[model samples]
Target chain A: MKQLVRVALLDSDSDVRFGRKMIISSNPKFEIVFESDGLSEDLVAVADGLIDVLVINQRLASGAGVSFYQSLRSLVGIKQATACVLTSAFDQPTLLLAALEEGVSQVVSLEQGPEALMNAIAAAKTGDQALSLGELYSLVLAETPSRELNQDLLRLVGDLPQKLESNLRRLQSVWKKGDAAELENFELKSLTGLVDKLPVKTASELVIRLQRSGLLDGE
Target chain B: MIRWIQRKNWIPEILLATFVFVVFGALDFATQGLLALLCSLVMSASLLFIRRFSFLTSALVLIFSTMQVSFSLLPVFALIGLLLVAFATGSFSQKPWREVNYVASVFGGLAFAADLAFNPTLDLAIFGGTIELTEAGRALTFVIFGLLAISMITLMWIFGQLLISRLLTVGSDIDRLAYEKQQLALSIQLAEQSKRFEIAGEINESVVQRISSVITNAEGGLYAAKASPEAAVRALEKTLSSAKYAHADLRRLFDMINLGEMVSSAPPSLEDLDSLTIAMRETGLDVSVSYFGARFALDQSAELAIYRIIFEALLNAKRHNPKGTKATIEISWLENGFQVLVKDNGVEVERKSALGANGMPLPYDVEDDIDSLLEKVTGPGITAMRERAESFGGSLEVQRAVGVGFTVSATFPVEAIRAAQDTSA
Candidate 1:
């Protein structure tokens, strides 16, 4: 017997939910653990153990998918999930950039067939980020750094910008060399052992810059 | 149109001119003969032009009045006519006119005092009595009368200026308040328009997603055709089902956007209720309106919402039945709220047969029962009507029975109905 991947679905429309369920359940290697059109606050209580993958729609009747996922990740025991796939009907650039900053695993268009979605879920279960070629190009083809990135950088370093200028030059070299993933996986724990460094919001920005420079789309 | 209103801004000058003719002209004509009457007439004429060309009026009045005093052309009682123009110069004329009136009044007072000291008969005409005077007494009398004339002229000018300024302050305050009210209303309209565009965006997203679902299932079936025949057949079956469902959803959204004949930007009021019922009756649905308690007021938006709910209910009745559908609209004005109930007998026969064909529906009070969900019927019209009611802090309730037909009721509180009246007050 194959080891079945546990999957759950979140979508408001009943017909969309039914169609997606029919396709996903036909695969023998994936198990349908939980299903709901909505899970207000009772999802934590109902889904006790943990789900391997959570496939959520972007434009839910509840709210935006990224904020919803952030709230869910803060719940006890649910934060340890291996993959979170955001399904969208359209490609919103701001949403893509936010997903990258928020550590979302992948964003797949709702127009994609079962094979593409199943592959995404299968790869995400093995602790890897996934992206389409189109999404990869949108992130890597940066004419200049986004306006939000510049504001975030200015906020990180206070006034007296001369020192900030030098620090940014060294930082750009590190990002271009693409050694951020190695630092997190370093044998001696070079940076994780260092105490009390950057604020949480700035740390999220650094992760986005690293992923953008490294071209870490996995696909 | 705006120019017409601006041209009428000199209404106070016309009124002041009328007062001068009535009081000064009539009194001088009755007491001091034609000469005094002519002098008062010229003073009134100058007052009429004070609002438009005030400096010129002042100059003309001074030059004319100085000639009369120098030539000794009239009686002593008419000499006080310069006071009227002094007040006018201060009230309506430019700054230069006011200075001319001040200097001219002082010189006129000195000349009049000299006349009164030398001419005893003229002094008696003005003061109602005269006194015998020596050489020293003549100087003292001239000094006293000059001071009295100056003080009386100054007081009249100051009074005119103070009264006119107070009137202007009140007028400007009212104008400012009216402008502010118009600005606030415009902003509210802009906010409502943006909300409509947002809804349009959501509708586009929803419609496209529904259509794409059918395509996704069919394409998946095409890829499956090379594998198992059974899997391919099942996928095609799902594809057909999704296509029909998507078509139904699209129709529902279409109905949601176009609720009724309310495409016009002007919102409908309860006054339009009579015409709505007349139109519904013309369509063959037996409709009637009945009211309870005295009719009261409601804000424009709330009235429009009620109008739409009634219109949708009547439409729903006609759509469900073939002909002769009896519907009643009961409007009740309560102490703290308003209520509307629409009851119909359209599907009474079909409902009883439905009980035998599909089994008995659960009672209306068992709201959470699963059987209620299966038997209840609601279309896009009903949902749209409910949303309209809820947006204004009101509510809608629906009921259905096996032997009876459909009923929908909506209620709005007094707070929403009285919002406009309260804000204006």
Candidate 2:
């Protein structure tokens, strides 16, 4: 018999938990061994042991969902776990981009219905990632050429700034030079200012840049 | 435009002349010359006097100057009349811009009409010192003046329409900014709550989890048959103490977060006043409260503003009185609106220069803060509170009391509250 897919569900809503559990039970291949309204218990347990997939809600207490993924990735042996964040409100582009940056397997909306969610979970089990149409549009638009935009245009469009842009560039330069002190200082102020103004994807681009340069040690 | 004139800029006068030229370019040469002379003279004279730079005077001066050619003696006579009107308009002028615009419109209208009526027809004929126009010429002159009058009327209409549209745009922009401000405040509230949630999560994991685990272990030990009675009792006591400490910490943490949250959230009311009074009592201040108003829902911002004004009043009392035994807080919702009075009988504090969190004295006096972090955390307390009251078309005031303490009060226009409630519903 094929190994049953182990799933962990994290949400603040009781109804979502019941619905998710019922939907998971209907499928023969997936089994949700852990479900929790609070991320601390179920997420820490999953990080400490074997868990094939993790599902989350958009409106976690704070950086609850993203922080869980960070801790899970840092776990000694469970580095390759697939992750999913299920959200009710799909308006927040920032949360979706954050899930992606944390190496989430997929982000599905709770409003997308049981079939679509089940399909996403099934895909994650096979190492496939899928984003909704809106998420796809946000991601595509996220790649817009920053150089083509001036300050006024940036304010009208993404509101991502150039100094923050240049700080990001300087961050890249410092990381390439292996100046950790300079990179840390420059990144702290620039990233804080930039993160507030820029879309999460653009901000994450810098994170990926730092990781590639070995300044940031994360998978 | 008058403010621009008051600044003594030449660009507007040149523009005004250009406008006149454009409007009356087709009039007979002599008539145009006379009108120009009158316009230039009156503009120069008004620029010298007329109390301040006024669009009304500029237009009036232009009119009177144009009238100089038609009612040569009457033009001088009209000056006194024009001056009287100007003085009357000036008296009504609490809003200078509006008054100036009014003055300008009147003057411009008079100039336009006079230029239309007395347009000189030089080619007709001269009788002694007076020039006579032929019947056709005289009729033609009136026709020309009629056309000019029609043109001037159209010009004034266009000017008025443009002015209204610009004013509307400005008004709309201000409304947009106010809405944006409210949205930004909401976003800040959400973000602050999100941060608190994260902090609470950490505390839950660290303190709550640890205590729960100890209690669970103690229970297991207590139930175990092999364990001695004394050992079990000690374990139970330790668990109980730890649980109590955890509970206290949780309560304190909630209080801190609640205080921060309440700064944004509207206070319950003067009726539920005891919660605030109780909270302040814990902070070591004896608070006395009073109120009198038929309960009605106020604008959320207005209520929050009044709450903050009171909160700040209490803080000021505490800051000034580190040794004071008690303080009095009095609040009343009156027909005029809400009022807050806080007083403490304590040692008079020698006012120190406002220092930031770092203990560095601010370089200059600021009603708010020089430190961005401190400003971000606490500075908005007073300003946002004031803005909140003002947002509901209300006024807020703060002042040092006669004997002791600081008094803060806010008054809302009776109509503003009603209007907001009606629109929101």
Candidate 3:
């Protein structure tokens, strides 16, 4: 018999906490040992030497998700715990970058459902990269291309213009409506991530052009 | 001590007169008999009251001179008495120079004629010994001596008049310079006061509004935390951000006040509109921004004015509007200028009085009209916005209708904006 993974959840939303609790309970391999609505002086007392995995809401009541994780990393007991960020639908890309820089092991979107959350948790426990395929692609797209492109590499990704046009139109509509809430659901990072998976040369050239034209960051 | 001397001007003149009187009395007592000595003492003593009773002293001196006409060298002493008469008359009278010259000529001529007629043969004194003069020669000598004495008196009178005129001119110039200095000081004071008022208006419009929004967001966060922890957390994040922004604004204002540089160093441009929209949205207001035409750079002051105008309009809309109200900002870059329009779907409310933060009555009157209501609610904010726009040769308009929402639009001329840009650059 394998030892059950001890997990701790910190979220300001009670519903999100309850949902995460139910999902972890369903899997016999994991057990929730501690939970909190926000980080406080008392949380330091409760979190001592108990949690194997720490799950936190990206938007905390007092500080940001990255900052909270940084604080937790300094604590003696939870320093070695696998850190994961539970994000909302409209989380900013800058915040995602911050979380990654803070050594967060996984980022699980609430809209991604319980299965994706479970997969991310399991992957985090096993010491493997827990980001989804699309998230990995976005990280790649966000990087600056180092070299120039050639025609032979471009040919590997067929019908590039059609896909680029489709994505551009979708982004334009979102910008025109000025509906920030709807923009969060559009998954712009995923579209760019798709482009980044093309042949290396083509992906590099395309990303450079998008960045130069200010289309990538939606300026 | 010098001021006292100036105030009692007659004291110095009296002391000088007494000194001259004593010297003349001793010379007369040694040279002449007791009668002449008595006449000299009487005339010299009268010099004490020369300044106080100048006319009486002149009369007494003339009487003493006439009584000593029989004396051999008494005519010379009589000439001294005639000079004293001129001095006393000139000092006592306003236009005494003409009278003094007439008196000196007549007295001098008569004294010389009396000396020639009464003692012409008696005088035998010369350079080393005695010399006798004929009657005709004595008469000619007396006439020449009288003419020379009159000329000397006239010259002295002319010099005294010049000294008085120069002193009067210097006094007038000092007065004019003092007046100019006072005027310059007053103008500088007024300019400083105006600058202080301008700074106050700027802080009231920008910093105060930001602080108020922070307070509102913090309260919202507190209430939301009780029901939905997630909502509370989001509200708290907003409150924190707003508070930081407000703090930065206050720091900037203080720096401007302390440094005497009222213009913003890093004023917000059109690129910053997105962040402002995001901030407003976080405060639970539905904010939308739209831009038309190609983007162009603007003068720092013009850009700051546009940003402030938009900020004030949005703040007013958010503060005065009902809950869930929607606001929109549209910016159009025209060929000759730029236009900004801010509109809100909120009902306009009537206000009973226009009062400032301290409950002091403001410049506007209370009314049910939208203009009065805006003036009452916004206080100095709207006035400051309008002033800023007009300062850059721009225009701002506020519109309100029965069913339509309140709207504010500002138009800025390209020429003025570019001119400001050139100056700053």
Candidate 4:
């Protein structure tokens, strides 16, 4: 008989845990050694050398995967563990990209159902570089602002026209949205990310609009 | 010395008195001659009391006093008599020359011109005098002196008025500038308050939607679970998942709302949104995901932006098509940074070009049909998605078909993301 694969799973969802357990229980080639809702200090200790294949959710009940991986890296070093991020939000490529950059061993999306997840795990045991939409999400998540702010900013910008027209509209929109809070929070750090990419006139118009909007009154 | 000089009009007064005394003394010398000596003495005494009179009244007094000087400069002092009349019967502040310097200058100029033009020979036919003058000389002196007098008086009056007008204008301009600054400050304050209201309104809308969705989903699960034990177990499981998200949602809403002294808690990453998708799917939407690219974690704002954009797109798709319609959501990081494409296939239905995201027309008037209701919902939704993208030094694009669907593409500069990470870390 082929050697049964030992798997370690980490995620916040009990349903997902149950579902994966059920899917793997049907297969004799896999066995679950450890399961957790999040990366606890105790789990991180055990995760360093004991686990062969680790599957973590993008989010844990206690903390995020990025922070978890960062902490894990310090404790166990990158060479010790082979980790995978199993996520449901494969619709966001940034999430997958982010995970891939983190050096996770495998990435899978629940959107593809249990069959794909099983295949991902089988591949991971063989040392195949298997990654999914979770990695893309990670990539996007790693680059943009907080997802909420990204959405708001994107909505504001997307309303604008494109190329030169887009930039012109962008300026008009930003100029319109300029308020006191925006100015106070408008850090110089994001200038290149947000304003610099806009047309000079449009960027200026946004600043002017915000200024005119009286958003900076108290400041 | 300056005060005394200011108080006295010695030159014109003394000269007139002396002229009168000399003419009368000459007449008296030819006639009685004794009266001329008395007139000279009286004129000298009056000059000593010159300070007691207003300049204009005093000038008139000197003119009268000098008439007697030719008769006799008497010791009783007609000048003293004129000084008593002025002190008892005149207002010094109301004296014309005391306030009107320009008037004084003009009158002085006129008097000097009259003296220069005076010719005894021209006047000899009317009254015989010792002086003589040719007709041409008399005409020349009169014309030249008259012109000089008029020019000097007109120039002095005009210059004085202009100086006063300029000072008045400067004061008023300063006052106007100060008023304008106050108005500007007030307008700025009003704008800030209005902006706060707008933000609060938007946050309220978001919260309402989130809370509503969560409640509705939870209620549905609870009801379904009550109907069937096994099914209830499944429903309970789903509710548990939604509960976590609902809690997270509430927390986020609180962070942004600023109800009190609250810190902006760190929000979820793009990675955390995987659970969001899973939770929302439990509420009854078929959300699909596909990806291609190297992986990287993004700033929290970027991830949230993309998540909300996709969430909105999904919500819009579901709202538009209820009966067994499939929505395709694609997220890819290509040669650019990242791209999001959400397309749905529903039954043939007509959508307006002017509708807003709420399915109403844009409240404000806009010309382009390219930004019609459906277009903005589809297009500007991505535009908003791009705002967060640009905040991370990324870009976004929204492309839509008439009846087909919409595609939203976003790209970020790798360098920008790295820089943000460096700072945030």
Q: Per-candidate interface C-alpha RMSD?
A: 3.3, 15.9, 13.4, 9.6
- Give the CAPRI class of candidate 1: incorrect
Cα lDDT tens digits, model 3, B215-264, are 44455455445666786676567667767777887787776566432332
Model 4 fnat value: 0.02
Q: What Cα-based lDDT does every candidate model obtain? A: 0.62, 0.51, 0.59, 0.49
RMSD of 1: 20.1
Interface RMSD of 3: 13.4
What TM-score goes with each of the models? 0.42, 0.33, 0.26, 0.28
Error of 4 at B95 (Å): 33
Candidate with the larger TM-score of 1 and 4: 1
Best by DockQ: 1
Q: Residue by residue across A1-219, what tens digits does model 2's lDDT show?
A: 999988877766543354455556557788887777755555557664566676766544434667666666665322344455444334355656556666565667544555666787776666554543233334534642222223432352233466656665565565455544554444243454554454322234334433433333311
> Candidate 1: how close is chain B to the reference, as a TM-score?
0.35
Runs in model 2 deviating more than 4 A are A41-43, A62-64, A74-82, A85-97, A131-138, A142-219, B1-302, B305-425
Candidate 1: stretches off by over 4 Å: A1-6, A22-34, A38-51, A59-64, A76-79, A111-115, A131-172, A176-206, A209-219, B1-209, B223-425
Q: lDDT of candidate 3 vs native?
A: 0.59
lDDT of 1 by residue, A47-155 (tens): 4556777777775666777766766656633234335777777666667667655546766776556677778678657744454323333454452334333444335
Q: RMSD to native for every prediction?
A: 20.1, 21.9, 29.1, 31.5
For model 3, state the Cα shift of residue B202 in Å.
31
Task: State which candidate, 2 or 3, has the greater DockQ.
Answer: 2
Between candidates 3 and 4, the TM-score winner? 4
Tens-digit per-residue lDDT, B1-425, candidate 4: 32344456665446544664565445544443455445444433343333344454445444443444322222222223332223222222233543343343344344444444452322222234434557677677767866775575455445544544455455565555546534433443344345445555665544443333334334434444444456546545655665566577567656545532111233334554455455435444556677767666555445655665676667666666654555666776554356667776543222334466898744433433354345544355455556557767777666554444545556666555532544322
